[model samples]
Target: MISARERLLNYAILIVFSAAALFPMIGVVAQALQFPDLDAGTFRDAWREGHFGTYLRNSAIVTAVTVACASVLSIMAGYALGVLRLPGSEALFLLFLAGLTVPTEAVVIPLYFDLRTLGLDNTYAGVILPQVAQSVAFGTYWMRAYFRGVPRSLIDAARIDGASSWTTLWRVLVPMGRPAILTMVVLTSMWTWNEFLLPLVILNSDEGLRTAPLGLSFFQGSHQTDYALLTAGALIIAAPVVLLYVFLQRRFIAGMLSGAVKE
Candidate 1:
């Protein structure tokens, strides 16, 4: 039933749209490959000559911890709000929703002072806790939507089978919501991996911890006007996120669409 003219139009639209979206990435890769010509030898050299191995490892550590903490907490929080009939549930849920409206900058000042007082600054716990807090609201909202879509009949069946509350969540609800969990993992990993502002403020030492993103900034400052290396650093910072998205785009789409298609 497809016409030749319609096909041509579709291809034209795709070419235009895809080109626009791809231009930045195409340019970055080209520049990185060009080395200093694209930016500077020092900048490109930072990834090659500098301690990128350490930066990558630190980033992975922080991202893994953040994602794990956010996923478990979000799943439990969302399940509670979606399924439990406790009093003041609406108020507690609103608190979670409020997290979405909060701007990180607004809280950073207070956060910094608190961490300093508690001697958490320059520590992984300090870097991580704030990121987790920032992510919790969005995570809870996404998870709640997904959990809401799970059939209540499933919960009833689990109860009839004498499954405990925790057992039901783990054995039944969590399994059914794999799509949403994968989506959360992707989102949290990307966010933690690329986070800058909070890390910049909370972290004081370059020793034992320097995220890839933080290192990119340091690389830029040290390299001065090196654009090629800048691109290379960007590639380094972006690689994991890009790879994960490419591999998991299907689950991402399914999770996000699951939220939208449900009530």
Candidate 2:
């Protein structure tokens, strides 16, 4: 349907954009490799000096818990709001939408104090809970849209087969919504992993509980002049999310495109 000239032009644009995006990443990797001895063990040195093992473990714990809780809550809430059409559902959906509008900066101070009062400060729960709430806000919105777009006839057929609502959701819809669910998981993981402010504020006095981004900030402060170490540390913090996206790129893209074409 398209002319060869237009297709070539599109390819040219894509290549240019891709190169532009990758250029800085390539530069960082190259700079990280710039060691005096050319084998100075920059990444190893950075890892040991930065104490990234603790930070990364903390981050993994927080991200995994947040994503799991948020995904489950979001799916249930979204299904209720999008499919069940319960009384007052629209109002409740708006409440969830309101959560999305509130910036973390606006409440981080009060939240810290409240968590401190509850003895949750400086703990994994402190970091994980707020992030779960934040992710659920967005996740509910995303999954609601996806569920709303699911064919009504398909749902009706499931119901006719003596499937309970819970069974229908788990067996029929969730499997069919794999791409959408995975897309949500990937996004929530990235956001929780890279979160800096929440962990910084909540775990201020607890070095052992620092997340990757918070740890990287301190690493940068101490190694200000050491570009190679800094770059290596940056890469180390970023690698997990990068690998995750690369692994899920196809599903992620498919989910995004599906949303585009659906309601």
- Cα error of candidate 1 at position 135, Å: 1.4
On residues 49-68, what C-alpha lDDT tens digit does candidate 2 reach at each position?
99999999999999999999
Tens-place lDDT per residue, model 1, 1-263, is: 88999999999998999899779879878766776465455545756754677888888988888889988899898888888746887799899999989888899889989999999988888889988887888888888888777888988999999999899999998888898889888988888898988888888664558788887788778877756566667877778888999999999989877777466
Minimal lDDT window, size 10, model 2: 31-40
Candidate 1 segments whose C-alpha is farther than 4 A from its true place: 1-23, 33-44
Superposed by TM-score, candidate 1 places the C-alpha of residue 144 at a distance from the truth, in angstroms, of 0.8
TM-score of each: 0.86, 0.91
Q: Pick the candidate with the highest TM-score.
A: 2
Query: Model 2 has how many clashing residue pairs?
Result: 0
Cα TM-score of candidate 2:
0.91
**Clashing residue pairs for model 2:** none
